[model samples]
Target: MTYPSYRNYVREPVIKVAGTGPARSGTEVWAELDRAGRSRSDRPLIVVDCYPGVDLSDLRKVAERHLPDYQVIDVEDAAALPVAEIDAKIADNLTDDRVFGVLGRQTVDDFYDPDALRQVRDQVAGRTTPVVLVGWGALLVGADGGQPAGTGDAVVVLADMPRWEIQQRQRRGAPNWRCDNGAEDNLRKIKRGYFVEWRAADRHKKHRLFDAMDYLLDTTRLAEEAVLITRDSFQAGLTAAAAGPFRLVPFFDPGVWGGNWMSEVIGLPPSDTNYAWCFDGVPEEESLLLDVAGTIVEIPAIDLVLQRPVELLGERTYARFGAEFPIRFDFLDTMDGGNLSLQVHPLTDYIQETFGIPYTQDESYYLLDAEPDAKVYLGVRDDVEPADMMAALRRAEAGAEPFDAEKYINVFDVAKHDHVLIPAGTVHCSGRNSMVLEISATPYIFTFKMWDWGRLGLDGRPRPVHLDHAERNIQWDRRTDWVTQNLVDQVQRTGAGDGWVEERTGLHELEFIEVRRTWFTGPVEHDTAGTVLVLNLVEGAEAVIESPTGAFEPYLVHYAETFIVPASVGRFTVRPSEAAVGQELATLKAYVRGTERAPVGRPVHDTKEPGLS
Candidate 1:
């Protein structure tokens, strides 16, 4: 049962706080609100606006227990639009497609009728007793877009949680905002959140709730306890994180083709099935834990991306992507499980014209572990007719027969450190028993799956196969011979220093990301070169990332964990830790090419060999 499992994976990575020694908790949050109210008018307004998916039951019960004299009002009951009307307004964004939808532009204001909002505001303003306003879109009643009903005697508090947690709740039957979709499919629920609700909520939160809030509450804990921190401390933590190395809190999930690798290595709950994916370096759905004194405050990782875009993503990257983290690192485990779906990604022009996404997903698979007999299905046979292949796929889709993949696909044997370069429009998938370190652009959901091997998903339904999208995007030129020459581990040594050497790995000329692998027995120096760096410890037991001039604290990393170095950190160094003083450690790092030349020129192969039987 011995394997390459690093059981030291951290479930909750945290950053230290500087300005706020200790944050408010349990009863202290209520006491702080009481004190603030005392300083205001005789009847003060306490506006508590929440992000989507926050539970208001605990908030209501706590408010009633502590502030017994105040009148608590839920804004949804007071001013929210009817469910049918809300659906009508968001219909264009939530298209008929179950898994894909248009980007929504509506704000929180669009969810409430004007007359209902005006009535609620007047009622709150004329109240004689102290009032506690709460729930999603609660800030829409404020006079100047974020203030408290045109008054100076009010305190605003924002209750928020990360989107990953929201998805988890959705899987457990939590409905989306203002909808009665409690029993909807989880995939559809996620699509609604991704395209419609999250987009609108993020816009509302950034402009209306980020700075103007007097107190920010962290409601991400399982016990449902609230961790309240001053707005000043929250901003300070984000600024500090952007100036050094940090890891986003990684979240794992199970799938039909999941595996036991992460379950054993990361020490996940045994009650659940195998872990299929780990989003370790994604800023969009992950959260950042800030350690303030002894309490931990969990906020969405996107907060840092929004608040300190230039510092985190660098000036050059910010100008291009505009507040988006362009690179993503994740784990795809098929160890002792099933192969991933046979798939192809859309080309850049196709994605732009059809999906409205500016960039396509061009990815590279760097294997961290693989069985001896493991293989990856890549490219097509050297002489398959496009019309014939399309007809076979349609027949397979109709259950005429199981797709004879071995007859048409090229399977390459994989080893521990092999890097596979897969540009967009190339057919590819990792076969069973391979732990993949998937590095790619951040549009992670743009995959168009072609076949699922006639297997139903974990939900007991047939998985969605995009045969039409796949037929139009797959390239016939990527046959066996050309792929064997261009797509496999095309590594070349770039430089060598004392006890250290660096190699350039190919991600194809069409991709925008550049990757470099460094192996060191001593110290290795690295400069950000004005863009951010996302790296994973692909080899050795442990390593330390340090600052050359003592600029920031030394960060410790383990074997399979991924961490990010912000562009604000100009120079840094990496060396083996004390535990692995003699071991030669290796790290695989990826960053935007930002005016750098591609590692290799485009492939110029056009062979017209006969088809394989």
Candidate 2:
């Protein structure tokens, strides 16, 4: 649960109008007084009247007698004017920093309805400088019909204008002062509706749980914010109101429901919904959807296929994938000198022929919190005969051309946030003492260990290794170094490159996968398409998400939890807590969709279909 810092002090004012008719006696006088109060009389007043019997010129003339200088535009049949044409006219007249006002019929017999009024209001509400409604009809801005434009307990209405005006005048407040949401300033055109608030947690039970919690809260916060922002202007307006340091958004977790429905009900990517870490506490035998490692839908997070969705704001790219099944795997954590079997993954070509599958296993490492000097074994150091490699494995000995973990494996100093990509053909193994965020094509941990030298698992049993698969797909003829910098000749940090977008945060949209380091100054809006999951560091600020169901409090960075942004949710946003430093808002590792479709021609290995379950 996170609340955006910028949301706390800002107010989104929605003006609701009522009654599509000329103001009767008392109403007309009140309207005139309101107009005068909103403007500087030293300049001429401009009024545009629409429709039969109501003449704005007459009112202008009446105002001129008192002020002596005023301009008024009278259109006998404003309703007859085309909406587009009328909009242009309004735009032209309201140009400049002029103190402007609009008075229109809220309802017109056969032609006007609530929607029409809303459309008209949208054109003028934000632009008319200072506006006052001049009709008796009711306005509806929040909670549908439950609260009329100006009344109800669910909302806060500020009436008693005369008293407020007197107090302001006594204080010698300038006539042109911008109105705050309070009554003393500009009266709310629509009453404040009930807003959901979430609680932010400052601490978590564990410290190493950053990666899992980061994706969960950040993704969830955006989804929640989108719902509130898209549903109502006021709600959208309130999004940035809850300032940061600590904030939370209360929302319903669709994962609480079981099975595939999680993706459908929440409307996020299939990968985004299921995580082994999410259902960790559940009895493993009870048909759990996720595992301790946060492997959702059986699909491991560490892979080349990164599917973190970001909702677009204003205008942006869009893409989505439907849900499918069979994405499953277990994640292993290592300590000290951790060991894994030297393995080979089947490529799309072999999988299709042998398993009747077309998909290839491409995995990547999202190093969450790594220990110093950690390394992973990648490809062989040099080429050797496939037959010789097989003989070495059979004899339980290191092969002649065996690769050194330091030289062949793309070795990095292994900081807390390092990310490394591992393709299908790359033989690899995770070294010791590092927390990892694994993103992969699927959860098929098919490995062929050419040599294990009798390593033991914690259970005091020899760690299992597969050799047949290794010999079949070993790329003996091609064994160049697999480190990114060594492989790519032009690896400058600044200049420019093609194929991907990389920042100091690491990489984004590399190949079909995009990874980003994001910091939000205010609420971030997200939309439905593919599921978006986030791994975030609470650091100092809080992250909150708002949704149609309600608000959720994911809290600050210390608490680790995975937040899922469903594919079906229309949109959502994330904001820092009030005390959050704008310069250091929550840091995030995010994944968004790309235009290149997943390789659909091939089927997945050891299972069915094209997607991770």
lDDT of all predictions, in order shown?
0.83, 0.32
Output the lDDT of residue 311, model 2: 25
* Alpha-carbon runs more than 4 Å astray in model 1: 143-151, 222-224, 595-613
Candidate 2: RMSD to truth: 25.6
- Clashing pairs counted in every model: 0, 101
Indicate the residue-level lDDT of 489 in model 2: 27
**Deviation in angstroms for 45 in model 2?**
78
Q: Which lDDT tens digits does candidate 1 get at residues 238-300?
A: 987998999999988888788887877777887456788999999999999998877889999
Task: Give the worst 10-residue stretch by lDDT in candidate 2.
Answer: 193-202
Tens digits of per-residue lDDT for model 2, 1-613? 1122332211111112122122122233334443533453222122221111112233334434433322222221222334454345434322221121222212222223445555534533333233222211112222223333222211111110111122233234322111222322221111010000000000110111111110111111111121101112222212222111111121111111112322222233455323112221111111111111221111112110112212211012222321211121122334333454566676657655544333556556555445566666656655545565566566564334443334333334455555655656666666665444555544242445555535543324444455665667766544554344422222222211121112323332232344344334555443333333334442333455545344433333322223333233333445555565454443333343442223111111123422311
Q: What TM-score would every model get versus the actual structure?
A: 0.94, 0.39
Residue-level error in angstroms, candidate 2, position 64: 91
Query: What TM-score should be assigned to candidate 1?
Result: 0.94
| Candidate 2 structure lDDT | 0.32
Error of 1 at 217 (Å): 0.8
